[model samples]
Target: MTIAAIIVNYGTGKLILDHLIQIREELATVPGSHLYIVDNLSPNGDAALLTEGTTGMDDVTVIGAPRNGGFSYGNNRGFDQAIADGGYDHYYLLNPDAYPRPGCLKALLAFMAEHPKAGLVGSRLEGLDGHIQSSAFRFMSLESEFASAAKLGIFNRLFASKRVARPPQDEAHKTDWVCGASMLLTAEALEKVGLMDEKYFLYFEEVDFQRAIIKAGFEIWYVPSAHAIHLVGQSTDMKDGKQSAGTAPDYWYDSRRYYFEKNHGAAFADKADRAWAWGKRAGGLKSLLKGQGLSSVDRDIAGLEAARKRAAS
Candidate 1:
């Protein structure tokens, strides 16, 4: 019944510290729980500032990482520490920008205990306004990847069932992966999967880890009843719901290339780049006839091409 709730923090120190305060009530409802924060060597020294929130909480512990190893590395530090501490039956990974609604953590712990096969479960994420953010998903395939980047309605129709991204379902359902923002992992499953891969600087780390979890013979579920509010892009410097070139950063492209090349192979990564490039062109042509720029076609073809080439090198 004991669980470790881990948060990975970068420059978002006080933000996550405030998050710790918000979850205090939920933690009390559980049989046993502890909070672990991994400070990823924030250049601004926000790591030192975060200690104010731990004031009188004996269950809270902080790990000061020697370097910034990105999202996966930071979370893995807490994961390893929790397992070493022993007696913890579950691990909950929450984004610094996320806080569970009342009874949210309880719902995840109760569900995992009820279903021994659900190795990992994710909370249903809603924004501050209570609108469901897309978190649960089908596993990515060439079809889904191409369909998502294509910006063509036909591709979506062709690959509707295989689509990789999906919103949280109204009912609980088994899924390929859930957003890392709020995931609960069982101790047995963590023992098998080890820890989150550090190779990912930021993106796709959860997808890769969840894929490995499934391969290790465990199910992942999206639990709608476990509600959490996530203000997207708090730590990553992305906002306004626009993640275009302006928001795209170097680590993101690097992570994207690494995920595809490491998991699917270099050749497959190149194929994905070409697929999106072709899809972008097709959409551009459609826009030309309408006398307008292609709309919402946000694929960064040049950046992806560069990443694909870097992976091949």
Candidate 2:
């Protein structure tokens, strides 16, 4: 196979089925490409719905995972299966909520072919309102995290402005990391970087993987000509509004801290990451104490402090 498009579905049954149809109809022209869906044990019992829905498609295969392996592990399962089957040159990690425009895969493949050092290539992403998403990003550092949390960085525009400004859409640029919502990775690149770090349950795994790819002498590219429409945060939107006092924000904080620590060592990662987390926690607490929203902000800060203490010891 030339390419294996792997989608890890977690409770997004209808969307996954829809994207499979789109992939079959639009990407069928590409020779030796197949669609592989790994259902991450959705709570809605819709994994069977997705499997049955795509049964008639020639290139579609659905694997029902026995448990929810989070994003990284789920996709890695599909990647391992594809490798065992042999002949696939590239693997496309696509999110269920992301719909690719026609020729998106082809454009990415062409870019990878032309750039021998390119390990992963990501497309331009737009939301339902036609505004550009920050599909490619610099690795999230202490400063970047603050800018994002305080809504003071470039990513702030991604949420606030209806139509955000972006670099010219015609060029292929190199970036530190690309959003995993729709990314294409060469099989050779995977061999070198290994797999997506499963330590990240939901977020920041892509940053870790891309860092490994770069460290292994590969480049991460952003091809703006390819396009995909992503329904941002649809999965999170379905969850209950209440945040878990222990795990909700701790997962993010721990994952962020882990990525930095794993790549940059414990001491440096601890100082930089703890400071940022403390600052965010302080801001959240201030917001709550001022007769604002819920007091979950304190829990978030406490979680970060706890994580820092654990790392220190």
User: How do the residues 107-197 of candidate 1 rate in per-residue lDDT, one tens digit apiece?
Assistant: 9987887888999999999998889998899866777767666668898988889887785578888999998899999888888988888
Model 2 deviation from the true structure expressed as Cα RMSD, one decimal place:
4.4
Q: What is the C-alpha lDDT of each candidate?
A: 0.82, 0.76
lDDT of 1 at 246: 51
**Model 2, CA-based lDDT:** 0.76
Model 2: per-residue Cα lDDT over 7-45, one tens digit each:
888888888776666777656867878888888898897
What's the TM-score of each model vs. the native? 0.91, 0.86
Where in model 2 is the C-alpha error above 4 Å? 152-170, 238-247, 281-296, 309-313
Evaluate model 2: give its TM-score. Answer: 0.86
Model 2: worst 10 consecutive residues (lDDT sum): 238-247
The numbered model that scores best in TM-score is: 1
